[model samples]
Target: MTKAIRSPALVVRAFNVEISRIQDQTSDPQTAAFRLQFWQDILKKIFVKEQVFQNIPANPIAQELFKVSSAYSLSKRHLEKLITSRRDLLQTKLFRNLEDIEKYADDSVSSIYYLLLSVANIANVHADHAASHLGKAQGLANILRSVHVANHHKTVFLPMDILMKNKVSQEMVLRGVNTDDMKNVAFEVASRANSHLEKARNISVPKLANQIFLPAIAVDSYLKKLQKNDFNVFDKQLQQTNALLPFSLYFKRVLNKY
Candidate 1:
């Protein structure tokens, strides 16, 4: 990575860690709210002032983020949206509809894409549009992949409407039952993710900005494997990581495709 992009990369990694801590550890709504507020205030200091890096939160993650946010002028709204979604996840499990799932994906996933683009100083409208859809695709794909793990944790990330439409129940999902209905529901969700991936592929971005979406390669590969298996979320095949993923991503990056 270029010097200009490295700090932002570090910052984003740190930011994701902070989000994971809140989402994976925090169980109390009030506590989650307070933790999110702390990060929000630190981000406010970075984006609202030019030279407040020295005065930003002392937490290592926040401190690194402040440097990148100050350097690249990352959008405060995007950063805050990232926080807000993690906070909401403390209480939100089953999405009411596909649209609700899509919105959650946009706020939680696309927000990261937008910030990375900012760090790369990409201001092109087309790239941002593509990133938005790509983020949604990746986010949904993630939920599909993690169904078993989510179920083990007693949380269902699948949209309730889709599950109902397919005659799958929360009980079936939580118990890892591989009913036809569950497979149908998984197919619908994967189809939505595939659609978004297709849309993202149709957009044109400059070579420099393409690296930001290299993750799409892995997302695409994983989705294809899931599709090939008839949308069986519990199949050990789906759980295993693709061995070819690294080479595939490298080739895609070399070709400058997201």
Candidate 2:
């Protein structure tokens, strides 16, 4: 009853886009509270108009934002907080090593999981679990895919443990080339990614995320391509999707349909 008279559907769409953009920029848990705040604010702004949102019990995200902005959902205050957070994204550390990159990756993907959970609602317990894992997996994949691009942006993606375990040096790999070192590093990362994919397959994905799973599949396909491409990390390529993927992934997901 106290909502601002906007539509929840539209709020969802706009915030979803905003969240996607942020996901592209970085995946830091430090950013979760900020992201959580963003959705909560949007929900609050529409509270006056959206009877559902207005009366909906304050979830984890809403409660946190309220501490900062008792009236934040109103006027320029809320928007300013988001803008400030967005601006901070551009200046992440110049990763001289993989350790830093992995740290950043953790933050980046965790932010995504928290934000997604805040927006999406799933009645089925299975659906809830699947979407939760899948979203985090997708975010992690995005961070991995962006390894090279993140370099250009002054960040890194792979963990040092992976680099060391595979006998790849951060310096040589970071330099990038058609060299064996880079290929080795790619193989190592891809191997790690494959593990993630196997895990993804093991868990039932939510059919509800099928529409949203475009991003998740894109991540898996990207990792698979890197594998097929002989572990080339230089090319910031999109996933070469097999047509069968959508049909199969969706069919299984329907069973867990949220």
Candidate 3:
């Protein structure tokens, strides 16, 4: 991102991170909903054109979000989707099926891309399409990556339909049981993510938007690593950071390709 958009982008991501972590930050459902509502209220204030600059929240993330929202004319719907989707997930922790997960991704992940594009002042349909697919890919990949940690908390984000189709039980996942059925579940989820990544790459986004899509490289790397391990989400190697990821991102950025 250029210096002009970098700070705003970071602010958006910061708000996302704060919202995404609300579930883990509190075990009580009401508490989580209340925290998310706090953000929703802040967003309402941020989007109010009359008092956006005058009545900024004391919270640092809200303050930055207020500035970003006002400067870029960011869509309140997109920002609200981020909060509402996470709040919905907080209430219904597990997805019913692949479609459910995709909807969640579209709301939680794709909204960030839409906001960033606004920051860059790019409004092409191709860019939005690419953002939509990449968001689903990254969102699915993130769930796969977090399976181990989520299992520790006795929480399973894997779609229940997939688990049922493979005859993998919630207890099996919670126990960290590695089995053929478990690997099959992982394979199906990873394949869906990979498919979305392919579609994202096939689309030609605006040249200026390539940097925004750099996350595609990281998503591609993770899917490849997951494949190499034979779709074993529990593989220890998957837990380690890929040392080459930074270089790969930069290389793609220089070529203006995501």
- List model 1 lDDT by residue over 1-258, tens digit each: 456686677788678768757756755678878888888887777766446666776788887777677667778898888888877777675688878888988998888888888888889898899998999999899889878787657788899888889888888888899988899999999999999999998999867778888889988998889989988998888888788998988787777776
* Reference-based lDDT, each prediction: 0.83, 0.49, 0.90
> In candidate 2, residue 244 scores what lDDT?
73
Encode model 2's per-residue lDDT on 105-199: one tens digit a residue: 33444333333333344245544454445544554465556666644544455665656666666565456544775677667555654564455
Whichever of 2 and 3 has more lDDT, that candidate is 3
Give the C-alpha miss distance for residue 221 in model 1, angstroms.
Answer: 0.9
Model 3, residue 112: distance off in Å is 0.3
Point out where model 1 deviates above 4 Å: 1-3
**Number of the top candidate by lDDT?**
3
Show where candidate 2 strays beyond 4 Å: 1-120, 165-171, 205-209, 236-258
RMSD of model 1, in Å?
1.6
Candidate ranking (TM-score, best to worst): 3, 1, 2
Residue 258 displacement in candidate 1 (angstroms): 2.2
Q: How many backbone clashes does candidate 3 have?
A: 0
Against the true structure, candidate 3 reaches a TM-score of: 0.98
TM-score, one value per model: 0.94, 0.52, 0.98
- TM for candidate 1 is 0.94
